[model samples]
Target chain A: MIRSITQKKTEEELDQLLTGIARIFIIGCGTCVTMTHTGGTPEVTEIKEKLLKKGKLVTGDLVLPVACDNLTAEVLHENRSKIDLADGLLILTCAFGVQTIARQVKKTTIPGLDTLFIGKETGLGQFDEICTQCGSCILGETGGVCPVTSCHKGLVNGPCGGTKNGKCEIDEKKDCAWTLIYNRLKDLNRLDLMKRYQKPKNFQREPRPGKYWLTPT
Target chain B: MVSLFKKALESKKFVVTSEVAPPKGTNLEKIKHHIELLKNKVDGINITDHQSSVMRYPSLGGALLVKEMGGEPILQMTCRDRNRLALQADLLFAYSRGISNVLCLTGDSILMGDHKEAKGVFDMDSSQLVATIRKLEKGKDLGGNDLDGAVSFCAGAIVTPEANPLEPQLIKFEKKVEAGAEFIQTQAIYDLDLFKHFMEYAEQFPVKVLAGVILLTSAQMARFMNKNVAGVNVPQNLIDELSTAPKGRAIEKGIEIAGRMIKKIRKQKLCTGVHIMAIGREELVPEIMSAAELG
Candidate 1:
């Protein structure tokens, strides 16, 4: 399943962010973060205890089915009284959920976790980023391997000098994308495609802050 | 109107080249001294561009300095920090200033350097960068716009001859050659038999190959490279030799080792020439060359 991988922010950063606000209401997601054990029920309860231990009032807390879902607005309304009792909302979810809560709630919203990447759960508690959504996909030529996301340098030509024994230079555990592509193409007897010169990627295809609207037929 | 470095490559008389890394700060004293010392000693001096992804004085500025000091500058342009437009613009500027040689590299990963947080802009890999230079020489840019003035250069790229799973690296090498890389500089090689095998394959390509020789300062550094560096396998015997160096004379011993390798490479006509990399010990290049009997 596609999961939004996230890591909890450091306590020091959270402490600095929550200063000057006493009462706190925590929110957690029951979807992706729940599977990752990052912002599930236990994490929300744990944060509440941590906040209470720091002499802060825990007004209330709950784990919504999907913090990023539109139902977040309705759920916040259902618990409006308890949420209003706090100075701010400590959201223990991905940035998408935190932003959704911030947009719906008038109280100050602080993100308790940082979103790392949108990755697929490859194994038990393991995630691997597969695509960058660069908009101009060349998977057809690269034998289904996305170099944009797989290669550390996002090189389209082939492996850089840093590839050693099919591992990336950044980390020995990470597989080199070009090596994977070479092996795949070599298997398919399409090694000639690897030799083709790939021009500079067209950044204009998907400019930053991308947006699109479907035209009604 | 061939560049001097290009002429040397064509001259086929064991062309010797080295590199000078730009400083991290504004001080040019060290770089200037190195350039002045090496201008007449080597055919061309490559000015490294934020080598190993550590931000430093730009290679363009250092190449200009080499030109100012009457030295042949081979600008080392990497795809780690610049987009296609910036790279083409820098190439134009370098050509306008009489800098003629360029060594195209798909630079080291940014994580390897001090600025671990910086964004790495690999807009074009080293092979594409070589192709871009060839395209620019035809009075056009990558954007397909005509230039008022065309640029010419002795373009080159690097290869890791000892890279594990060497086929992928060889594929990239062939692509670079097909993209018009006139010269090829290899990563530091210690195993001559392995390098000879690489050369046997490289001999099929129509490009001048320069064997890369990095000076080993100490045994610990050698071991560190063998452990930490990718594709740089320092044979255990060489490491033992460095470890056995008498006290503080390891640097001289290292020079002896590097010089001996170069002497052997040259005597055997291993490749077209040797591209010596003294790393931080740029001052010792001439000594190394002397030891190799090239001086």
Candidate 2:
């Protein structure tokens, strides 16, 4: 499963953080991060209420779509006076969004959430992080289930023999990665393909940190 | 002519109703189980029309499934997605197929659902939809156009008693009653004190009111709704009670809480009936009624 940083800070933690700060400004993201419930207008409002209870003056709050995008700078520019008046900035966005806003703002900025990896909604109100984005998409040979993405220890080959009755060694309830692979391949009638020796994954082909790409016009 | 639902309200005995959300896919076993469980317990089963703007198996199909299963279905119609023409056509088709009850709603905003890019066709709000139903009963269309055959329904509308600005909801409630709405179902009410206060003011009106009883899953679920869901306040004490339950016993706790509310409402005879919304946990309806000692 993908490991995303789950922000479990309670209202009490927020109150303690904003105790001395007289003026606070809140910034929220509107894209994938916000939809995932890490940061949004609603979450920002909740933080604002906590700060108010702690006697901190919440100057203003705004949600920008794709806070990491250049458009966020324009939104901040439009609300510059509010941003400038604040003693501290609380950014309720992904880590990237927080960094982008911090780079643009002249005031002191802090992140309200630690960014986790990409996840998928398993059910209503239930999210399971399933991808670390390891700079590769290896669904072609793996039957759509990424062993590198899902396994807790990121084991690429067969199970380490620690698995008991298809459950992972790390967690009893979680499925064993090799077991899932066997089942998926068996269902697809491609069990013979698992016997072949596969080449080691090329690290250079994956998306590395500091790498940037722009679409051709 | 006034709706038949208004005529049914003349009876002194209270009525019972429940809602059933059709599965997203073609799974019929769960839906069938719910229908069977609620068959004798409720006077009608309201099949919701794409609740929360999320697409699912069609409401008409679900209603038909209920009809086939020998259950009376109150087909819920929302004006958010369908235009007037489609609305009128569907109503006519429903009436032709012998479906009776119709609950009109303005529906949830399109921005809240998975399909954000989908355009909302709010051709008519709930009030206008009620008025249109009345017009159909008179053998006429919304555009003052004539129809080949007349149609009738036990038309109903929804009200939120816990609205902070109570006057606007009251105004809309009155307008719906005026627009030939014979019955009204309210939004989920967890705070009885507030509900009693709302009833004190609402009782003056002539229409029959059914208090909505939404089954709580957990105290955290209740708290989450209170924090996120608009116009719903589950109260802090209730939240604490739900949160403090022994692990895996939260559902039982929720049922107990719902039963307590139902018993109080029934003992007080506050409203005409209760509309139980168990959400996905419809199997607990019998348990809830049994807990309240209703049946």
Candidate 3:
């Protein structure tokens, strides 16, 4: 899943960097990050109002449909004159959106938010990490349960001695990921699948800054 | 080594067991006294593993103490604290130490425990833990690595007959039995008639069933357990009785109630045994047994 995350930066921190700059443009995201109310149109509007109250001129704002999309670059080029009037760009979206905007704009782009993690909403107003972008998938052997991301210790052949009553010994609030995988496999009556000792995860950290491709169509 | 508990399960007579909650500190005097007092009276002594999600001295440590004091220990193992590797390793350790009986549990949610910030490592639930014991007995661990020596255990798991939505619990009960659980202990059960209903469905399985009897020391304790403890429904009548008990005689009343239930369970041969959870009230378990006329 193309998941985004929550913002952690505060308004005051954003204001500190914008010190003497008069006019400021705000940009938000309409997709994934927006799902958490971080970079939505309303949030961008709220920030604009705050900037106006701070005595800084609010040039304009836009909640792009997927702030990381290349189309956002085109939107920035179209509003170049409005952006040029401002000393910097205030980003309410994630790091990807901030960087994307920065690449296209002459003005310094300052991020107003810090991204949290790649997770999905597991319950009403609750988001849980379902994947760690491990670059490889092992859900089939684990009875459709993802152990790498769910487990705190992330043991492939798991259940260290500290586990008590299916709770993680490290962090008691979280469910033991390996325990979950075991139960799921048991219910499916495919417990034999757990017999195969999975080798330590090859995190595929090679070629440091990772990239993915399909053959250029 | 096969435990006396295993022998009791195979016997025709009613069996008895009681639990001991290890102290939060390093003091083992209370545990030693309880073991000395009730060791021979009951079939086995259960040492709780961080029961109710609260961290106490390790149950395994207490189990070793029980063995040292010449008492049979059913090491209570929960899936909350450790992952599979640790679980299997501990089982090996327990087996090596001659602590052979195990009560496998999925454990209470960490949200209910002393450590709220702690993460629950439910790498496996109770059902899975039972299966793991069976696998260990077969000469290999969950990862299929052959061991230097295989282990054997009289494995057990928990059931909550009085759970409000019992169908899910029933499903888990069946799964636990299927996972090679030889005996099943329940959470605190008050209403005998309600327990009878649970037994009606439970009788079809081959596993032994032990009705859990948590001593109701006072009305407040009963109400508190009713509100906080899952699957433990203290009927209004028991609460009413505790409420009317003469001041400072609540323990006597609690013993009388526990005795009455055990007496009835034995008289009717309802199940294989009664697992008494005299939490923090270990000194009074013998009185409960005497009141039941078990001795």
Highest TM-score: which candidate? Answer: 1
Model 1 misplaced regions, further than 4 Å: none
lDDT string, candidate 1, A41-129, tens digits: 99998999999999999999999999889999999999999999999999989999998999998999999999988888987768899
As for candidate 2, its clashing pairs are: A1-A150, A2-A129, A2-A130, A4-A116, A5-A116, A135-A206, A135-A207
For all the predictions, what are the DockQ values? 0.84, 0.01, 0.11
> Candidate 2, residues B1-295: lDDT per residue as tens digits?
3333334456676666788999889988889999999877877889999987798898988888887887788899987688888999999988888788899887765655667778876656677788889989999987778899999888888888876445435655776787778889988898898999988988888778999998889987897777556567788888888888999999998899988998899889999878889999988988998888886
Give lDDT tens digits, candidate 1, residues B131-230. Answer: 9999999999998999999999999999999998888888899999999999999999999999988888899989999999999999999999988888
- The residue-by-residue lDDT of candidate 3 on A183-203, one tens digit each, is 787799886676654543455
Error of 2 at B106 (Å): 0.1
TM-score per model over all chains: 0.96, 0.57, 0.73
lDDT of each: 0.93, 0.77, 0.82
Question: Residue B69 in candidate 1 has what lDDT?
Answer: 92
Flag clash pairs in model 1. Answer: none
Find the 10 residues in a row with the least total lDDT in model 2 chain A.
A155-164
TM-score of 3: 0.73
Candidate closer to the true structure by TM-score (higher is better), 2 or 3: 3
Best by the DockQ measure: 1
Q: Write the per-residue lDDT of candidate 2 for residues A1-217, one digit (tens) a residue.
A: 3323336356566556655678999988877556667777788888788778777888899999778899888999999998888998988887778889989988777777766566766777567667766676766666677777665434443333233455654466677665677678778977554433333344456445646659745
